[model samples]
Target: MYSKVVMDHFKTPRNVGEMKDADGMGEVGNPVCGDMMNIYIKVEDDHIKDISFLTFGCGAAIAVSSMLTDIAKGKTIEEAKKITNKSVAEALEGLPKNKLHCSNLGADALQLAIKDYEDRKAGKVRPPARPEDRHEHTHGESCKCPYCNGDVNAGLEFCSHCGKEMNDSH
Candidate 1:
């Protein structure tokens, strides 16, 4: 079950591809984790001139990426940085309570891209390495689903409680 806005974005997401000429880029999580997002930004004079994203995730992640770019485009860096998980969830008219953390990444991804741009400008740091991708994790009986935080079989591919796919990231 999803809101119309959520479904609309999931069915036809905006800003869904990579921007090779981007001024900055940010990535969240590893592919082995099974829900990763990358954000690219082209900024001009402290304003966000353009934005795009590549999200290898579920419907909620796609919608969050689309809505995030829509909100950040044309805003000043300071303004865009203020965009948060709570605000993006609200922009979607709200996500299922269990899916709220899915919204936490939009602004974080953007802010990291901005920080990367700044770091590059100062030559103080190279873009950070992506987190190490690890898998074959064996969860204990107490482990919970990363998506819904619901109880799940440690070996299951899908959460019995939420129907969300289970991954090493969980």
Candidate 2:
């Protein structure tokens, strides 16, 4: 069952749609659930001046993206970077256990967008966005652990750095 807050957001999700001239953008998907989220942010003076999203998923995923934009808007880059899956879920008044991954996608997308913004500010050239390039591993040949963004070896059941259970969809 969804919470009232969750239902509210889902019914009338805020900040929905694409931003054509976004300063940064992030996209994430859950292969298992077929959930996808794209977040766009406009930054100014080290703050999130505007934010929006386009989500293709269940109600929970849509709500999470809406809440994430509400939470990140107007916050400084540093503050927005600290937004997490737990926080987004909590803001939604909690998601179903099965739908918690929706929160992860929302948070991860936000962080990735912020990272993209910073990267552009530094004049770092990045390749065109591609499905295979969604995640950039900091550790060579290792994927990032969704729970902690730590290095995770392929086919591992748990993250060696964070000790969290790994889901194949990540």
By lDDT, who's the top model here?
2
Where model 1 places Cα greater than 4 Å from the true spot, the runs are 127-170
Give stretches of model 2 more than 4 Å off: 30-32, 130-170
How would you encode candidate 1's per-residue C-alpha lDDT over 1-170 as one tens digit per residue?
78999989889988878899998898775455456788999989989999999998778888999999999999998898899988888889889876776787666788888887777777876734644333434446456888788887876789999899866555
Q: How does each model score on TM-score?
A: 0.76, 0.76
Residue by residue across 1-170, what tens digits does model 2's lDDT show? 99999999999999999999999998888444578899999999999999999999999999999999999999999999899999999999999999998999999999989989989999998778676645433335777789889878876799988899987567
Enumerate residue pairs that collide in model 2: none
Error of 2 at 27 (Å): 0.6
